[model samples]
Target chain A: MKRLKYILMTLCFSAAGLLQAQESMKSLMDERRENREANYAKWGPTSEHDGMGFIVRAGYVIGGTSPLPLPAEIRKINEFSPKGGFSLGIDGYKYFNMRWGLSAGLRFFMQGMHTGANVKNYGMSIVMGEDIVSGNFTGTDITETRMSGFTIPVMATYRVGARWTFNLGPYFSYWIYRDFDGHVFDGYLREGSPVGQKITISADNPAFYDFSDDMRSCSWGMEFCADFRVREHLNVFGLLDWGLSDVFKDDFQTVTFPMYPIYATLGVAYYY
Target chain B: MRKIFFGLSLAAILGLVSCIQDEPLNAECDIEQAVVVTDDAEAWLLNASEAVQDVPSADTTIVFYLREEFMDENYEGWDRLKDVAINFRLTPGATITPENGSAHDFTQGGVYYHVTSEDGAWQRNYHVMFIPVQPLTVTYDFENFRWESLERYCEWFEYSDQGNEINMWATANPGFAISKSSATPEEFPTIPWENESISGHSVKLETRDTGLFGVMMNMRIAAGNLFIGTFDVANALQDAMAATRFGLPFNKKPLRFEGYYKFKPGEKFQNRTGVIQEGWVDDPDLYAVLYENTDENGQSFTLQGDNVLTHPNIVALARVTDRVHDFDNWTHFDIPFEYYKEIDEERLKTYGYNLSVVFTSSIEGGAFCGAVGSTLLVDEVKVTCEDEDE
Candidate 1:
C-alpha cells in the first residue's frame, strides 16, 4: 500500500509538468500565428485572407514544338537550338483559405526553335506562286518555327507552407503570329508521291517551304506551376506548359506527324 | 533557396529535352542501284560501265544498251538476255516483287518490279529493259507529240519507217514541270502549235518565268529547248550545264542540215538574276554538231551544253550565224557541215561518231539568261548525208 501511494504521487507530479509544457507550446503557436497575421495585414496583397490579389510574372521560355517519339522518316537530328524566347503574364488570385486558392491570368509569350534534321521520304508541300507542290523528300531539312500568342490560364492553387504554392489547370491561347518555314538541301523530291518523278535539290539551290498559314490560330493546353516565396512580395517560380492540341490545323497534311508545342518557363513573380 | 529554385528549373528543362526518342522503321521504298551480273559482261554489254547503273531517285526505268551484234534478231546472243540475272540495291528494309537477283526475259519488253517499304505503307514500281542502241531518224516534222507525266507536259517522239515509236528527242519540259506543275499543256515552254505549219503541226518553243521557285533557286527563267539527246533531270538543278547530254551514236556522215523556223525576240532582255540588261536583245539558236564518241583512250565520250562546240573531239559544226527576227513568215535555212577534224572512215562504220541537232528559244538560255516571252517556231527539219563514194 505504501509503494502504491509513492507511485501515484510521482505520476501526479509528472502530469502537472506535462500540462505546463502543453500550455507553453500552445502560447508559442498562438504568438507565431499573431505575428503572421500582423505581417499579412501590413502587406495587403500578400495576405491570406478571403480576398482578391494580383501578381505579375516575367520569365524565359525554352522548349520545342515537336512530334512525339519522332517518326521514322526523320533519320537523324544534325543540330538543334532554342531561339531564346520570353513570357510575361499578369494573374489575379482569390484565396478561399490559407491552403486553397484560385487564379486566372492573361499571359503573352513567344516560343521558337531551329533544327536541322536528315529525313527520308518525308511528305511536304511548297508554295510556288499559285501552285502547291506536294511531294516526298529524302534529304537534309533545316527548319525554324516561331510563335507568339496571348494566353488565359484558369488554375486551382494549393499552398503547402508560408513560402510554397502549387498551381495546375488548363490554359487557352490565341496566336497572333506563327511561322513554320524551312529549306531542303542536298536531297531529292518525288513529286506527288513516293513513286512520283524525282526532282533533285542541290545545296546551293535549296527548296524553300513555308507553312505558316497551316498553323492553328487557337490552342488549349495544361500548365503546372510551382512558386517559392523569396521576399515579402517576390517569388521565384517555375512553370511547365504542355500542349494537348497540335500546332497545325486538322486539314494540314504536309507534316506527316502531329506536332505539339511544349515549353517550360523559369522566372520571378511580384505580388501587388 | 536559390539552389532549390535552380534545381527545379534544371529538372524541368532536362525533361523537355529527353522527349525525343529513337526513330521508327523506314517508310520509303525505292531502288537505288541496278546491275546485270554476267559471266562475260564484255560480250553482252556495249560498254563495261553499262553493266551497272546508279538509278536516280526520280527514275522508274532502268535501261541497259546492248552491243549491236548481240542485238541482231538472228544472233544467238540475243536469247542470252532471257537467262541473265539482275541484282538491285534497294532502300533499307524494302522488299521487291519477283525477288532480287531473279532472271527475267528482257528481250520481249521491259520487266516490271514492284518494291514495298518496310512499314508496308509505301510502294514504287520500276521498269527494267535490255535493248539494242537506237538510231536517230534522218527527218523530223515536229508533228508527233504526246501528253506525258500524268498529262502534265508534252513529249515529242518519232516513228521509224517500220512504224515503231522512236524516242530520239528530248526537251526541258519535264524540268519546267517541277516549278509549274499546274500549268496547262499550252502554257508549257515547249508545245505543239497548230496555228501555222509547213505540213503538219510545228513545235513552239517559248521562254517562260519559273515563278517563285525559280527565283528562290536563282534560275528565274526556263527557256524552251529541243535536242537529239537526253535531258538528265537528275542533274537539272545541281549542274544544269552538264544536265544536257548531247548527241546520239551515228554511223553516217552528215553533209548538210536544213530546217524552217520563225523567231521573235522578247521585249525586255534579262540576265540570269532576272535583272533587265540595258540595250540587250534575245535571239534564238539553231546548231548541229558531230563529234568522236570515243576518246583517244577508247573510253566513251559525249558532249554537254558547256562543251558541245568547244571540245577538241569535235569533227564538224553547222551553226546558224544569221539572226532571224521575222515572226510572221517562215524562213528556210540550209547550212553545210564545216569540218574541224578528219573523219575516221573505218571508225565511222563502227559507230564511233555522235551527231546532235539542237534548237533553243534563247541563245544564252543554258545559263538561265533569257527573255520571258521570246518564242521560236520550227518545222520540217532534215539531215542530208554523204554518199558512200564521198
Candidate 2:
C-alpha cells in the first residue's frame, strides 16, 4: 500500500510538471499571436471587406511519371522484384473566406513491390582457382529494392486573389504494409536449420523474403497547392506534397524514393 | 453591455473547445501509423531474419504502447507540436522461450538478433544472446553454457574454364578426442560408427569442377557424444553444437602431399606435426599429423595420448602451392605425413601416430566468380585404419 502511494504521488508530480510546461508554452504562443495581430492591424482597414461565397473547380493532374521505373525495371536493375498496385486520390475543398476554410476528403492508395531469388552455388574449382559454384560466398550483399505506403491528405487553403488560391497544409499518411526480399549464400551458417539438422547441404539454396505489418506507420508530409479558379464555382489546380522526413517509428535508413506524389487532379468540384 | 460580454466569453470558450484537435476515431490509428515508424535498422533486422526464416512462431515480440495526453486547456492543433520522446528497455530476465523448450538469450551474441528505431526521430535499445546450439535441459543459472572463442578459417576459391585445369589440396589442423578405438580394414569393414555423420560445415578440401577450397573446424566438434560422427555443417547453425579446436593458419597455399605409415603395438596416440613440404620454405615449418598406435594384441590405436600439441603447431599448418591454378576437379593428391621428418621425430619424442591417407585442395589458385558465388561439398569420406574392436 505504501509503494502504491509513492507511485501515485510520483505520477501526480509528473502530471503537474507537464501542465506547468504546457502553460508556459501556451502563454508564449498567445503573446506571439497578439504581437502579430497588432502588426496586422497597423497594415489595413478593419471593416469587413468580403462576403461568404461558394466556388466550384475542376482540374487534371498528370502526376510526374513516378521516379521509380515499372516493377520490371526495378527488378531487373536491382534484382528487387515488385508487386503491383494502384494509387488513386480525389480531394474536395470549400473555403468560407479568404483565410479561413476547411477541406474534408479521403484518398485511396495501394502500393507494394518486392523481388526475391534463391542463391544456390557452393565449392571452389581447382582449374580456375576461383569460386566454381554459385551462391556460397557470404558477406553484406544487398539486393532488391522494395517500397510501398498509403496517404491521407488534410489541408487548409487561403484565397490570395479572385482567381488564385494558396494552400498551406499537412497530410497524415499511414503506411499500411511493406515487404523485403533478398538472398544469402555464404558457406558459413549456424550449425543447424530452424529445427536442428546436422546434415549435408545438397545445395546453397538460400531464400530471403518477408512481409509484415511492421512496415506500417504514421508519417507527416506537406502539401502546397496553387489553384487558379477558372470560374466562380470551378477551378483547375495542381497539388504537390513532399515527404519532409522518414515514416519509420525508429531511427533507421532514410527512405529515398518519391517523397511526394505530385499529381494533377482533373476532376470537378462543387460549391454551395 | 455585461450580458454581451458574458455571451462573448461563452463564444470564446466554445471556440477554444472546437479548436482542440481530436484523436484518431479508430483504435487502428496508432497501429496503422506504427508501420511508418519502423526505421531502416528495424527493417534490416526483419529482412535478415525473414531471409533466414527466423521469426517467433508465436506472439512474443516486445512492444511499446503510447497514449497521448493533452495538458493545456487550450491545446489546439498540430501546429502546437509537442516533442515526444519514448524509451524502451529490455525487461529483466528477458528471454525467448521457444515452444520446443528451447530458449534464447535476448542480450548476448547478436547473430540471430537486431534492433531498429525510427518514427520521425529514433531512439531504440535492445540486447540479445545468440548461441549456436540449443540447451537440452541445463539452466543458464548453472553456467552449463559458455560462449567459446574460436580461431576460424574462411577461404574462397574460383576456377575459370579458360584456365588450365589444375589439382589442389590442403590439410587442416587436428584436435584432441576424449577417447577412441582402433581397427584394421578387415576388422571394421564399414566406416566407423563414430564417424558416420560427417560435418558438412567442416573446413575441408572442396572440388567445384575447377576451383579447390578448404574450411577448417576451429571450434569444438559438438554433438559427438552419441558417436563421433562426421561434422554436420547444417546442424552447426543451432547453438547446441560443440566446438573442436583453435589455431591460426600458416600455409596460404592448398595443402598437397603424400606419405605412408604402418600401425604398431602397445602405443598411445597423441598430437604431432607431420613432415614439411619439399620445395616450400620451412619458415616456421608448419604441418598437420594424426596420432596413431597399437595395443599389445597388435590392435592399432589412433587415439590421443597425454602430451597435448601446442597451439603454435596448429597455427603453423599451411597449404603448399606449385602453380596457383593447379586446381580442378577431384584429382588424386597425397601427402607423405613423414615429410615433416623433424616434427615426426618430435612426435616420436612423445607418442607416434601414423598417416593413412591425405587430403588437399588448390590453395594457390585465387580467382573470383564472375557474378555467381561458390561452395564446397564433401560426402562419403572414410578413414582407413588397422583392425580392432576396442
Question: How do the residues B306-335 of candidate 1 rate in per-residue lDDT, one tens digit apiece?
Answer: 998899999999888896899999999999
- TM-score, model 2 to reference: 0.28
TM-score of each: 0.88, 0.28
- Tens digits of lDDT, candidate 2, B67-87: 112112243422222321212
Candidate with maximal TM-score: 1
Candidate 2 wrong stretches, greater than 4 Å:
A1-96, A99-104, A112-152, A160-163, A180-207, A228-236, A251-272, B1-390
CAPRI rating of model 1? acceptable
Clashing pairs in 1: A198-B58
Worst 10 residues of 1 chain B by lDDT: B12-21
